[model samples]
Target: MKLLHYTYRKLSLLLLLLMAAWGVLFYYAIIDEVMDETDDTLENYSEILINNALMDPSVLETEGTLMSFYKFRPISEEEAEDYDEKYYDSTVYIESEDEDEPVRVLKTVFRMPDGQYYELELMISILERDDMVEAILWYLGALFLLFLICTSIGTRLILQSVFRPLQRLLDWLQQIQPGKELPVLDNPTKIREFQQLGEAAVDMGNRSYKAYEEQKQFIENASHELQTPLAIVRGKVELLAENESMTEQQLKELDEIYATLGRAVRLNKSLLLLSRIENGQYTETEDVSVDEVLDELLPDLMDIYEGKKIHLVRIKGEEPFVIRCNLSLTQILVSNLVKNSLVHNHAGGELYIETTSSSLIIKNSGEHPLDGEKLFRRFYRSIDGKKDSTGLGLAIARSIAISASLSLTYKWQEGMHLFLLVKESEKKS
Candidate 1:
């Protein structure tokens, strides 16, 4: 996802969290106020009933059938004994005497006009309070759902306005390509940060494209310049060899000069290959099997190591490992890695090659230890000033690996140097 899209999502989530918190607080506040009012009203009504009952207990006791408050028939006289243990689901009961029962009693004493004794008993309905709480809860839940929906819509609309310019900027940036100028930034961004980023992006694109042009020109010019000198050197060596009057020492010296010139020519060729890979001239790609490439290069490897005591051990894999890549570069990358292993190995050391589902691994025991990080750097070596080694083996391997959209990694395990070639598809996971 793009940065603007991610930022908008986060902002919407933050707003949603805030709205939820505010809604919970509002619900609790309203519920508390409603409960307080209900409590006061119930208390006042209980007091009035108690005052009436004390003036006349006849309100609770009936002649034919005893009636309680609100004219509800009380239990029969025979059922009264068990009625004390029984409970009505909708009503609360209170008694006048003993005062040890769990039921609530609203008590008050009032003197009769004729000085007669009377006991007043009253019960309140607890269901009304329960019903009021339930209703408030139901309303709170419904309002919370409504608030959630409204916040969601509001968040989407607000973010759309805020991020519209960002989306445009992203589309513009993706359209940019190397060696091309950046498109003009025409978006009227309300956000200051986005405007600054747009300006920076345009500046960076121009600078990088210019640098790329300069680098490519330098490589092309240097390759051509080196080729002219190489041609002159080869011509001089041929003329010297054609001469017959030269002394024995002069001939040996001339031969050494020719060999040195040959090494220089090979080094220049390698540099030219490196530059070509860097310039991305080989854009053709195909689904190439790593094993097939390895197999095709096996004869060349055998020719190079013909006299050496190194044993080449090839462990074939059961499954086919295929990747979309440039064929020549892939062969160069794997060949360079395997050749580097052989060149650096100890005398009579074993060179091992194997493949996994995602990669090819080459391992060999060596006389020299390598700093893995410095191995890929141009013209860097762990040995003390060894001129026989070009030091470009790993560098070339790395360059080709990158061009093929693969990774070339080196590690040391159990006194053996391990080089891993991971295909691009494997790296995605």
Candidate 2:
């Protein structure tokens, strides 16, 4: 989830909980206040009736009147003494409505001037009050809903404005490349934390760019400096081998040294190529067909290993297997993979090359399977190592594939070793 949405969810939940708790409390408080007011009104009405009855006892004789609802009943002296004022809710039957309605009732003891004690029961209709309370509750609920909606909208707008700078920073970070200069961040903000984050990001990018430049320059200089010395050494060894008085033992030694120097030169060149590919130096790209590359590479490779009497088989799908990559790197990738197959194949073995619109597969008959895990590691030779093999061919192939956004995998099946290369886009599809 995005930061804004995540924050909003938590805030909304807390607000809802608070509103719910407040709503419950407000409901009870309103009801309690209304009940207290009703009780106070009932007490005042009872006092007024007692004062009127003391002035004229005829008012006590009137019962079941519209404005005055009360009943007077005679009580013993002991009963009047033990009586206490009581207030409660009850149902009363109204003849006009022909139904029962809720009311508040108050009971009290009053002594008449004739020395007789009586109980006074007074009731006030509360049906209208119940309706009023219901309306108030609904009004409160509506206000709560309106407040919730307004707060949600306001919070969303505020959060969006606050996070705009972070969004811009993310966009800037996406455009950063290993060899490219860092982009200028122009998102202005008043937030101190966001400003500090932007500064840290810019500093880190500059440091990374500097480190990358230094590493690339060092690799290029080292590779170039070693090339001349290696060539001179090999030339001297060749010249020494041609000496007329040199014995066979000495000549053989010179040849061995020359061969070792050749291997060193090849390893150095391979390492430099790998480094360049990783550094994004080969950026030029074009659509190249896998079938076309293999058509040219296999013929030359077959001629180089003709003494082994290998049979080459080609399987092409109806559609062409084409990909976008650096043309020179594509050629090197294909050459390395085919050369690896030929170098490890058994005598008079079969080499099968298959192509489809999405992938290329090469299977070669070998005496045994190569280690799948270590096959792509540089300087990893097979169990039965070849004298001329430098152990960098597959590693170089894998590096080229990665630079081209392709996947290269190795597997052993049946009695043959298989190398598969497929485009990442096609794999996803």
Return the TM-score for each candidate structure.
0.65, 0.77
lDDT of each: 0.71, 0.89
TM-score of 2: 0.77
In the range 1-429, model 2's lDDT, one tens digit per residue, is 999999989988998889878877887887788789888988998888888888989888877565447988889999998999998888877789998888888999899989999888998877565686688778878987898799999999999999999999999999998898998899799999999999999999999999999999999999999999999999899889888999999998888898899999998999999889889989889999988999888888899999989899999999988988998999999999888888888889999999999999999998787788899998898888787778888988999898888999999899999999999987888
Candidate 1 local lDDT, residue 288: 85
Candidate 2: segments with Cα more than 4 A from true spot: 45-145, 239-260, 305-312, 341-352, 363-392, 409-419
After superposition, candidate 1 runs with Cα above 4 Å error: 1-138, 179-196, 230-268, 318-321, 355-358, 384-386, 427-429
Predicted candidate 2: what Cα RMSD to the true structure? 4.5
Per lDDT, the best of the predicted structures is 2
lDDT of residue 429 for candidate 2: 85
Tens digits of per-residue lDDT for model 1, 176-202:
765566677788886999889878887
